[model samples]
Each structure stands twice: as C-alpha cells, then as structure tokens.
Target: MEIAIILISALICMSVVAIKLSDTKLSFPFAMKKQLFTAAERQFLMLIERAVGNEFRVLCRVRLIDLLSLKTDTNKKLANSALLKAGNKHIDFVLCDKNDLTPVMAIDLVYGAGKDGHNVQRDFFVNGALDTASIPHVRIKAKNGYTLAEIRECIETKLIPLRRRQGKIPFVAANDRPEVIKRSTKPTRPLSTSRKAVA
Candidate 1:
C-alpha cells in the first residue's frame, strides 16, 4: 500500500512539473504598447490635420525606403548598402496627396538639433537623400501655440514649389475641394523648396 501511495504521489508531482514547464514555455515576453503615438506626436498630428485641411494626408513614422527607391542600373553591392542604411530609418511625418496617396513631402520635428551629432548626421543623410529625389523636406521646431496658417504656409511656400520644379503639379481649390477628386481629370504634379525656421 505504501509503494502504491508513493507511486501515486510521484505521478502527481510529475504532472505538476509538466504543467509548470508548459506554462513557462507558452508565456510570451511582450506586452501591448497601448499607444501608437507619443503625446507630442499626437498633438503635432492634430495641428497638421488642421493646417493642411483635406488637401493632404499626414502619414507618421514613414520609413525612408517607403519614400524612395534606388536607381535601377546601380551596382548590386552599393544598392544593398544603401538599402540597408535607409531601411530602418524613418521620416517623422510625410504629407501625401489625399486622392492618390502619393508622397509629396517629408517633415521632421526638431528640438535644438545642434547638440546631437547623431541626429545631425541622420538629418544630413535624410536631407541629402530627399534632395537627390527632389522631395521637399521641412523641419519644424517642436513647440506650442502653432497656428494653422503657419503650417499652411510651409506646404504652400515649400512643398508646392519643390514638386512644381519636378513637374508634379498638385492642384487644390480654396473651396476645400481638390481638382484631382474628379477622376476623369488629370493634371501635372507640384513642386516646392524651403528650409525655414519659424521662431
């Protein structure tokens, strides 16, 4: 009877051990981030929405590769290097055409970048890449009390002209209606150029 009891106890211990092991093995190391944007980012996004109105769609944390493509004839090794360099990097925000979702400009939120060499270098690479592609990149200082008119000015004064030089004309009417909304109609793209600081 004691032997049988001992065997039963051993079986119960083994079962407990197995259950513990299974629970440990199935446990995940991740928890929900529970947020898509930081408080600052969310506030800025709201400002951009008000600033651009319905003319543009603001995309956040857009990867660099998503905004640019390498030349077809370039060497394989160099292409890989370039791709790897930009693959993980991202623009803070990108303004795309609302109708076609075409990327029109890049915007980075800046907060006294002179102190950070890493950020400065990163911006240099991003600026050079966007400049090469003729895409307008606007750096806006992070602060409170930004008016809608100021953001609108950035798009009108910088984003529009840069794309115009590339023959990518973007048309928008003051009536809160974009000309491209009429699918049967087509027009040239837009252009813009500027790197102004709004104090």
Candidate 2:
C-alpha cells in the first residue's frame, strides 16, 4: 500500500509538470496577434473606415488585412462558407474577425496595372450604395487623393453631412425615450495630429 501511494503521488507530479510544459509550448488558438499592414495601407484603411462613419473600435483591428479581398468578393465568401460546410480546416484570420462585432469594410486592393475584375465588382458595389444608403458605402477606384491628406479630406466630408443631419445639438438616446435632438450639431473633431501605431 505504501509503495502504491508513493507511485500515485509520483505520477501526479509528473502529470502536473507535463501540463505546465505543454501550456507554455502549445500553440493555442487566439495565441497569435495579427500582423500590422504597411503604413500606407493602414492609412488608407483608416481613411476609408472614417469616411464610412465607423469609429473604429478595437474589433476593427482583426478585420484589417494585407488587402480587403478576403471578404469583398463572392468567390472568397463562398469558399469560406464552404469551408464551414465541409468541416475542413479553419482559417484563423477569418475566424478571428468573423464575429462581426463591427461592420466589415471590404476594400479590394489592386496593387498593379492589370485590372482585376473582382476589384472592379467590389468597387461598384461599394460606390453604388453611396447614392441610396444613409450609411456611407465603400469607396472605389484610386481617388484624386491617394495621399494621407486626401484620405482625411474624404472622412471630413462624410462627417460634415452627418453633422448637418443631426442639426444643432446631438442628443443621447436612452431607454423608451424619444429620439433626443442634439443641441449642438458640431461635426466630429479631427485628430490634432495623425499618429502611426506601427512604423
């Protein structure tokens, strides 16, 4: 009995050590951080999101990509959907961002000269909604301002109209209350200066 008890305690000690070592080395889901896009790309994205009136909560980070093709095109969507259907391997980036906590902005980025039909279609969908929807749609084409300044200009323009719609003052909506009109219709204040999260 004494020998059996000693062996059991030894086994328990070994098991605890094994678990501790595995915990440190194991590649757990959600262990990796998303890669940051290039400065120019991030600048472009921030501009687009701001133009569309998303305040860009932390959830926005996951959706940021090397390019927006991940969600914008139907083929990719179908492929992803099929993956779910098949119970095949999961895509980490897509899964991480799929919770849809924030609105998804699918910007189809075409880096070079040859035109991509996928990109063209995405742009059409994004821009076409501008005329019909109150929510700002995704912008298409390389606009007059590809520069950071240009991006800022677009966001500011969108904010201007939203402010106008709100009238003089903005009011907070509360439980079972009437839509409170805001007393101040001031536009959103611009950042004092742009800061890059990653260089």
Candidate 3:
C-alpha cells in the first residue's frame, strides 16, 4: 500500500510541474487590426496615390531602418550609430521603380504650422544623410489639395538630374587616332562634361 501511495504522489508531482511549465511559456495578448494609418495620413496618401497615378509605386510609412544601411565594413560602432539615427524614424512616402522596386525618391510630409526648430534640425540631419548616400528626397507641406502636375514636376526636377548622372557614359569616336586610344584606357572627358553633352 505504501509503494502505491508513493507512485501516486510522484505522478501528482509530475502533473503539477507540467502545469507550471505550460504557464511559463510565452503568450501573445494582441490581435492584428486592419487600419494602420491616421485619418490625416490617409488623406495625404490618397493625394500621393493620385499624384503617382500609374507611373510609379508609392509606399507609405516606410521604416527608416528598412531604407538606410551602412554598406561599408561591418564596424559595429558605425553600424550602431547609423541604426540609432534611423531606427525610430520613418519616411512618409517612398517612390520606387515599379519593375525592380528601386527607390527613386523619399518624401517627407510636413504638417501643421510648419516644422519647428527641433523638426528643422531633424530634417537637416536626415537630408544630410540622404545627400551623402546620393539619394534624392523632397519635403512637401501638407495642404488641402495637391495637383498631380505639381508633384510630377517636383519629382522630375530631382529625378532628371539623377538619371542624367547615372546614365552618362564615356564616349569614344571611331575616327579617333589609334595612338590616343592606346594611351587612354577610357575617355578623357569627365562625367559632368558628358552630362552637358547629353543635355
């Protein structure tokens, strides 16, 4: 009888331990919701959608962490610094190439009384980072309505120069002397000179 009691006690102990272990496991208390944007943001997104129309893909509220990265050697210090600067922030809209999803430009929407001093400083920092990385960005003030033409013009103004710079290639003349070609592996003219030529 004592042996049977001991076995029963061991079984009860094991059951208790199992219950405690199950309680310790992680539990998710949250549920997924559909609406992700505020009312004002939705209105702005509609404007962006209308502006972009069928030409380019517009992504809303893109995380800065997803966009910016340190492409050089994985120096933890530098990587951490870049992440710290960009981790919490997000761009209002990102225009991308429809085919390959290459980011064409980043747009920030400034609303309500224009950016204050702190916002100005933040903008300067973000602008500096984008410029250093050779990415084009534009800041647009939130207004009642936006015209497609205006948006197109703004994008084209920045994109045209970038496209020109990216498309430029060295030109070699068929009639150029063999000696000149032999002396120079590439064209002597700079890319900026080619830009002028293309223009």
Worst 10 residues of 2 by lDDT: 88-97
In the range 91-178, model 1's lDDT, one tens digit per residue, is 8889898889988889887765443322543467788889999888888877777888887887677866755665787556488664
Clashing pairs in 3: none
TM-score, every prediction: 0.64, 0.31, 0.64
Misplaced by over 4 Å in model 3 are 1-25, 31-34, 113-121, 163-199
Tell me how many clashing residue pairs each candidate has: 17, 8, 0
What tens-digit string does per-residue lDDT give for candidate 2 at 1-199? 9999999999999999999999989966676557566444565566655544434322232222221233344597775654454342111111112235433232344444434332433334334332333334333344335755665564445455555665843555587587768687676777785875776
Which prediction has the highest lDDT against the true structure? 1
Cα-lDDT of candidate 2:
0.45
lDDT of 3 by residue, 101-198 (tens): 87778888876665432143346667877887777988876677667788777777778766666675334567664764347666676546534445
- In model 2, what is the error at residue 150, expressed in angstroms? 1.8
TM-score (C-alpha) between model 3 and the true structure: 0.64
Write the candidate numbers in order of decreasing lDDT: 1, 3, 2
